[model samples]
Target: MERSETTATTRLSTWRQVKRMKLLYLLLLLPVVQLFIFQYIPMYGVLIAFKDFKVARGIWDSPWNNFEHFRTLFSDFIFLRALRNTLIISGLKLVFGFLAPIVFALLLNEIRHVRFKKITQSISYLPHFMSWVIAASMLVEIVSPQRGIVNYVITLFGGDPVHFLASKTYFVPMLIISDIWKEMGWAAIIYIASMASISPELYEASDVDGANRLQKMVHITIPAIMPVVVILFLLRLGNILEGGFDQILNLYNPLVYEVGDIIDTYVYRVGLVEYKFDYSAAVGLFKNVVGVVLLVTANLFVRKVSDHGAW
Candidate 1:
């Protein structure tokens, strides 16, 4: 048949093109090998979740406990507390932290003055490059009750000096606000780049129709970069179980643990601090499985709502 001949000819042409680009394929080999060695090879460690893993016996010789760890995890109060905290913290982060970057990008794009815009942007994202350790120290100083600037201001206003970090009422808000402040401008870079790619002709057409800056932003700019926004949201959703481990670990104290403790910190305390490796590994596996399920469901939901989806 003519169709069979055309298919054969197409395959031959594709083969020739690939032969021309063989060096690029050679360049790609390094990362493929690294992915296997770093990401894929370590996955066998998940077997620890199913085993009563002893250090002396090693993974291979460790006897299978068959689902006992999982059974205990569901019944355990500590594990349940970590799970609940992870959900609450991560959900609040998605609610408040998600839109900060998008809003930053939109506001930045409206700045017609080039020099001020550049300086402001440089300062805004600077905190993102700082390690959480240094940031946490600075945050503690700012919120410290005895001699801190925040308390000094409160005293000036005749209000009582309140310890922001130590309070259950204020701890989560501090976390959210600090997180948004640190990461907003850095994350906004994506939306800014997407906005830059929009054709000027559309804006020109909008100008012809007497559209204002805000109107153009809502109708022209936002719609154009929505696919990028949705993709980033989906990726962030997939990592929802993580709950900003490094930030919380650096900033939180025993006093705040009742409100601030999450899955990663819980895992650290269980596995490293208490040396319950098998139990910690099971918790980690549960986190990853939930992440995967959320990712798939988000993908499905996005597909129904819009044509631009991860699929």
Candidate 2:
């Protein structure tokens, strides 16, 4: 009887706690519903990756092909080329783009003047808000072989005008540079916020110990935000296969397809343009599987090396 009364009291306490937080629970309803409708609901279409989907027959009625699409996807040379480019481009961006924000944030944190810092941050972030189409248009105007300011400047220096947008030699570098230019400032916002949260007392103590700004940044600021860095790195690893489709689609042309093509663009060409939906679905599935594997591997490696991980 004592034990039964104790269980009843515990249940009553739990109920009262939940009752007190009812409004907070209600606040989560919209996001949960949106996730279900937009994310989880679309997962059902993944079945088309394994099936010979026809519009007339619809997704449910489509006949299964038993990995035929996957076999075709693997055998296609174009798909392999796209896959290679995706890895190369995404890898380069991961290395350079990942570091850009960290460096920018650290430098911004070192800035003592408040007004100058805000103005600089605002200017940096403005480009991130611009659409890829607009950014690509601006890039094209700047790099135009015939009348662009860049080529004109080169000519004034006694250099030959080179076609940068159409040249495979410069395509990848341009992609990386443009991407960093657009996103670095926005990305640094998180790191700057993280740096701001570090204790002022630690910096004071470091100053007391004769530590300079650089030394304090290395010891206090970076260490305090190392976990955030690790988490962001892991999240980026999950997108190792995504090579910025919108930017590439807008900026790339047939002349640069060999070096600029990526999995997402290939999917758009085959699935949407050519109406080979199943093949595109197969390619997408492969990309997603690789992404998941990379994310898991990176998470595991990070966990082994440090205390931080996605989980």
Clashing pairs in 1: none
The C-alpha RMSD in Å for every predicted model, in order, reads 1.5, 1.8
lDDT of 2 by residue, 16-67 (tens): 9989999987898889999999999998988999999999999999999999
lDDT of model 1, residue 289: 100
Candidate 1 positional error at 134, Å: 1.2
Worst 10 residues of 1 by lDDT: 302-311
Q: Provide the TM-score for each candidate, comma-separated.
A: 0.96, 0.95
Query: lDDT for model 2, on a 0 to 1 scale?
Result: 0.94
Q: Give the TM-score of candidate 2.
A: 0.95
The candidate 2 region of ten consecutive residues with least summed lDDT is 276-285
Point out where model 2 deviates above 4 Å: 1-14
Candidate 1 lDDT over residue span 190-237, tens digit each: 899999999999999999999999999999999999999999999889
Clashes (N, CA, C under 3 Å) per candidate:
0, 0
Whole-model lDDT values for every prediction: 0.93, 0.94
Number of backbone clashes in candidate 2:
0
